[model samples]
Target: MLFRVDPASPVPLGDQIAACVRGAVAEGTAGPGDRLPPARELAGSLGVNMHTVLRGYQKLREEGLIELRRGRGAAVAGGASPGRARLARAARQVAEEGRALGMADEAILGLVRAALAAKGPPPLPGPGDGRP
Candidate 1:
């Protein structure tokens, strides 16, 4: 896996790391069942504190994108393909924006439901799907 962190960026290092992994998953460079580099190794390579990488991995774990095993390190969870990862990220962003605008959870969900209803069922994906 290719992970990069910018210590100078305003974004927290842990968040940056998590974002990189998420982007890779969204782009198909990382896929289900793939094992991530050990936290210490990644921390050494990125020149960041080991705990930072762990935090990022923990975040991904919470998102159901990865599973952390006691001695097995972290491995991408099953079913988190590029398309699903992208959708999860987009849904989170949309929820956050709605909350920032003082929308309640039910209200946001209702809007989503309305939008989905208007669009009807999504067309079956074709070969390659071509989503970004």
Candidate 2:
């Protein structure tokens, strides 16, 4: 897995690390039972402090995406599905807020449909593709 840190971004280093790991897991770049690099090693690679890496790992652990062992370091937890339920709840809350702001459901759903259509197709090669 590739880890990158951008100092110019407003997000904190640890939060950025955590976000990357979460995205990797959701996108299947990091799979269940995969072991993460040690905090110090990853910190060195990213040019950040070890504590920053540790904090990122701790956040993942709190989200049930990783398990920390005493001597073995951090490993990916099996079945670490993204929080879809939480996202749905958040979306509902956002819709409520939008209503309070005088936005219509039709406008919101149209925006969502346009966003989905703009994403194009999935890139993963499937059966019967020309490229070999």
Judging by lDDT against the true structure, name the best candidate: 1
Model 2 lDDT-worst window of ten: 83-92
Per-residue error (Å), model 1, residue 82: 0.8
Most TM-score-accurate candidate: 1
**Candidate 1 colliding pairs:** none
Question: How do the predictions measure up, each by TM-score?
Answer: 0.73, 0.63
Across 31-90, the per-residue lDDT of candidate 1 in tens digits comes to 999999999999999899999999999988877888899999998889788887787688
Q: Please write out the lDDT profile of model 2 over residues 1-132, one tens digit for every residue.
A: 778789999878997887777777766778778899999999988899999999989977877788899999998788575563244334546666778788899887776665665585855555686642
Regions of model 2 farther than 4 Å from truth: 82-132
